[model samples]
Structure formats: structure tokens, C-alpha cells
Target: MPAIKDSRIIILATNGFEQSELEVPLNELRKAGARVDVVSLKEGEITGWDKNDWGTAVKVDHTIADARVTAYDALVLPGGQINPDLLRVEDDAVAFIREFHASGKPVAAICHAPWLLIEAGLMRGRRATSYHSIHTDMENAGAIWEDKPCVRDGNMITSRKPDDLGAFVKAIIDAVEENASARVAAE
Candidate 1:
């Protein structure tokens, strides 16, 4: 069977998300046969940040107001300096992330995306990694921050930056497949 076949993955992002952080994982997950959706803070579309400038826009599959954590099997948070910074301050976004984490589903965050986990109060005691610039913020929030390319702690997975996309995406697929297998075994 394909890894994560029939699994539904939701990518939570907003304007100014890191381009590759979102696109690469989304593409990889879909290639692994998972149904991936881009859920944003607003409807219509969200633009990405390509290093120094705004990048291409991705169509929104669902808005925060309509996204329900139970509808999907996993969550993805793509980091850009502005994206997670904006999401961390949004009550609905933070609530959604908190609820998702509580569900015990897989959550893969890359680059600055871990900021949302910190804001949602889910970082404490978990081993994770993110963009080097935010190491202190992550540590102060009670997370065991590492400088590795990718780190997985239970249902949460994280990566340092774009260069870690391969490892990051693989972790996500592995987590999803493991979760699926667990569910089947339980049944």
C-alpha cells in the first residue's frame, strides 16, 4: 500500500508563509497518496514568501472558521517570519492548533512554524526543531529545542529549514502511516 494512502492532511497557512515549507511538504504528502488540503485564515487564496519576495498564491481549501480538526488525519504548519507570527496572535488559529494537538494526530511543523505550537501551549516537554533564529523562543517556551534537520516527538514532527524538507516530509508520512496502523490494530 502507498504510504498514507487515503489519509487526509491539512496544511494550515496564511499569507507570507514560507514558499517551500508549504509547497514541498504538500507535494510530497500528495505523492504519497494522501489527500492534502490548504487551510488558511481567510478564504479565496493565500500568498507565500519566496525568500526575499512574495511568491505564488495557493488556493484555500478551507478557512479557519470552517476547518475542523476531526476532519483530517494530520496537520502541517509552514513557517515564514510573517506567517506563524500572524497566526500565533489569532485566537481561532491558536485554538484550532490546540484542539488538533489534543486529538493526538500527527502535526508536522517546519522552520518558524513551531512558533504556533509555542503559542498554542503545546511545546512544553516536547522535542522539536525550527529555524535557528527562534531557538531561544522555543526553549523559553519549554520545548527541548534541537539544531537537527528534523526531530520527531510522539505525534509532533519538526524541521529546521528548507534544506530539511526531504527528512521533514518523510517524518510526516511515517507518522501518518504509523497512526493509521495503530488505528487498524486497535480496531
Candidate 2:
């Protein structure tokens, strides 16, 4: 596996993110030695949604208005019913995701986070997976939905739900290391 020690990752989210969805990758990626930032819609912090209610608050490292896509190697979008739904409507959030995906960097969208991908116009002809609840929404947006734990197509890494996070994170690290290797080769 990749250590990802030199990677700079950004987790873009707002309030109501899935608790484990954000926390797991953040902790695991950091343990792999990556510098991870939790970028939200504002400063201070953002709260996550747990099983039945609001969960822990993750500190905000930066806001979407202040972040630049070129500064990071990958982007993680954690999902909950509310997080992506709210973010997808924000013009800045959608635009940033679009630009980042266009840059060909790894963009991981777990569960409902795929909604952001749809809003960014990135799902056309892409193979992906997401929380079962959004199957129709995903298909309508032009994605080829697969019923798997994780689906990696091109630069997009997506997962079905929390139980599939292990595979999701692995795919992300693999993509990051692969992209890094490609860049080094080109140089």
C-alpha cells in the first residue's frame, strides 16, 4: 500500500456530514502521513450526522471560498443525507468539485456524496456506487451504478456506505500513489 506521506488531501464538507465517513478517512490518511484538511463552508467547525442524530464536530481547516484545487492531491466528500444535499446547491461547492475533478486528481465521494458529483456534471458515463437510497438519483445523472462496496472509475473513487469504508480508503490511497507515480514518470 502507499504511505501517502507526501500527499496533501482535502475533505470538503459542511454541517451534517456522516460522522464515520469523514472521520475514518481523515484518521487513516493522516496515519499514512498525509496532511489532511477539513475544509467547510466556514471557519471554526462543522458537525456530522451519526446514526440517529448529530454527531461529533470536526474542526474546519479552511473554507471553500479560500481553498484552491491546485493545492491538493485529492478530495474526499463524506456523505449523510444532509451534507451533500446542502452542498450540491452551493454554486461555489459545485464549481470547486467540477474544477477539481477536471484536474484529474482523485475525488472520493462516499454514500450520498455522489450527489455532489452529479451536480458537478461529473457522472456522465462514469461507473460508480453509492448509498442504496440514491440509486435512482445516480442513474438519472448518467452514472452506471454498480452494487458494490466501492467503485473506482478513472479518477473518481466512490463507496456505497460506511461498512465499505475500508475498501474506499484503500482505493483512494492507491489512486493517489498511482497518480503521483505517473507524474514522477512524466517528469
Candidate 3:
């Protein structure tokens, strides 16, 4: 992957985010030259989940209430049973996601993170994939769900689990790069 000069990426996560799911993709995106911002429901550090135990903490760059979708080129949602579950209940988080999608920006969610999409009402008629447990919920939300490593439908991308982080990151970087090029061409 090449450095994505001038591109900015936002990862929306909270406490209980799958450890590897957030770190791996964050590292990859940085290596690819995108400025990554870890945004959450609040300021301060957010904890990660490492399998059965708690993992490291990542500092939150901005709170959900302060995030402006127009400032970012892409969005990432890292999943854990608790992270997205908690995020979906926050009106601000859900609204932020809804605005990000409505703005036609690239949005990627891995594992259970797509639950935010369901909560934000952005899944209708869109094709997506998520951790196996939420397939039905995605279907119920009106999305054409698939069981794949990664699925990119329009500006949204989704993956199944931590194992899919590589694919998930690649899809998001590609989407952001493509979006950048398209915007440049249009201008």
C-alpha cells in the first residue's frame, strides 16, 4: 500500500473494542499514510478486549459529539461484544454514523460493529457482512447480508471478525483512495 497523503481516517470505538481489531487496522492505516483519529463516546483513554482479558488503552482523539463527518475521509468501527453494543445506545454515536453514511463517505465496520449501522438505520437494502451472530439482525435491518471476509457496498464496508481486519483495512484504504481520486477528478 502507498501513503495516502492528505487523507484522514477516523476509528469510532469505545471501551471493550476487540484489541486486535482496532490496533491492527490502525497501524496499517498509519503505514498507508492516512492520519488516523480514534474517536469515541467521550474523551480520555478507551480500553480494549484481548480475547478473555482486558487489553491496552488507546487515547481518544475526539468525542462523538465533537466529530464532524465532513472532516474525515473514512470511518472505521472496531467490534467487541460490548463496544458497539454500548455505542448503539448513544444517540450521538448513532447520529454521527448516520451522517457519515449520508455524506457518502467510506465507512467500514468489522465484527459486531455493524450493529451501529443497524442502530443508525443505514442498513436498509445495502449488502453487508458481520460477525456471524448478527447476520439475522442485519437481515432484519433490511440489508442484503453476505458471509464473506469483507463486503463493500457503496460507501460502506464490513467484515466478520478480528481475523478479517487485514481485508477490512485494505477495503477501507482502497475506498478512501478511490474516493479521494474521484473527488479530485470532479474538482
Candidate 4:
């Protein structure tokens, strides 16, 4: 896929985010020449959750209070049981995501991160996928749930789990590039 050289992507996460899910896509996006930012509920650093324990800490670039949906071309939500679970209840985080979705920009989530989509009420009637444990939650929230590695419906992209990171990241890049192209054509 082509690189989103000038696109700006934001990964909205917090402490307890699945380590690989957040790091892999963040690295991939930056490597593809996109400017990626990590936005969380608080300032400073957010820690990650490794397989069975707490993992590395990542610097937070922006807090939900200060992030603007219009400043980014895409939004990513990385999943870990605690991360999304915590974020779903934070009104600022959910509203930030909702505004981003309404902007028609690519909004991608992996694993349990789709929980935020459910909270934001953006999954209704959209085709999506997430960690198996949340399949019921997603379905109940009105998403057409699938068991695929990656699924893209309009500007929303979702993936099953860490194993699907490669495909998930690729899908996000593709969506951002497509959105960029469309804007250029419109201009």
C-alpha cells in the first residue's frame, strides 16, 4: 500500500493498552511517513500491558481535553481489557471519538478497543470485528460482527487482535490515503 506521507494519525489510548497493539501500529504508521500522535485521558506517560504483566511506558502527546478531531486525518484505538474498558466510561474520550467519526475520517480499532466505538454509538449498522470476547457486546451494540483479521466499513476499520496488527495497520493506512486522495480530487 502507498504511504500516507502527509497524513496525521492519532492513537487514543491509556494505561493498560495492549502493548503490541499500540506499539506495532504506531511504529508502522510512522515508518510509512505519517505523523502519529498518542493521545490519552491524561498528560505525561501511559503504560502498556504485556502478555501477563505491565509493560513499557509511552509518552502521551496530547490529552483528550486538548485534542481536536479536525487536526488529525485518522484515529486509532488500541485494545487491552483495561484500556478500552476505562476509556468507554470517560465522556471526553468517547466524545472525541464520536466527533472524529462524524468527520468522516478513518477511525480504526483493534481487539477490545471497539468497545469505545460501541460507547460512542458509532458501530450501529457498520461491519466490524474485535477480540472474540467482545463479539456479543459488539453485536448487541448493532455492529455486523465478523471474525476476520481486518474489516473496513466506510471510514471505520476494525481487527480481531494482536495477530491481526499487520492487516489492521495496513487497512488504516489505506483508508487515510484514500481519504487524502478524495480531498485532493474534491479540491
TM-score against truth, every candidate:
0.98, 0.98, 0.97, 0.98
lDDT ranking of the models: 2, 4, 1, 3
Tens-digit per-residue lDDT, 134-184, candidate 3: 999999999999999999999999999988887898898889888888888
Which candidate comes out best when scored by lDDT? 2
After the best TM-score superposition of candidate 3, give how far the Cα of residue 28 lies from its true spot, in angstroms: 0.5
Where does the lowest 10-residue lDDT sum fall in candidate 1? 1-10
Give the lDDT of residue 118 in candidate 4.
97
Q: Compared with the true structure, what per-residue lDDT tens digits does model 4 show for residues 1-187?
A: 3449988999999999999999999999999999999999989999999999999999999999999998999999999999999999999999999999999999999999999999999888999999999999999999999999999999999999999999999999889999988898788
| Steric clash pairs (candidate 3) | none
lDDT of 2 at 45: 90
Q: Which regions of candidate 4 fall more than 4 Å away from where they truly are?
A: 1-3
Clashes of each: 0, 0, 0, 0
lDDT of 1 by residue, 1-187 (tens): 3359879999999999999999998898998889999998888999999999999999999999999998999999999999999999999999999999999999889999999999999989999999999999999999999999999999999999999999999999899988888888888
The root-mean-square deviation over C-alpha atoms between each candidate and the true structure, in angstroms, is 1.0, 1.2, 1.5, 1.3
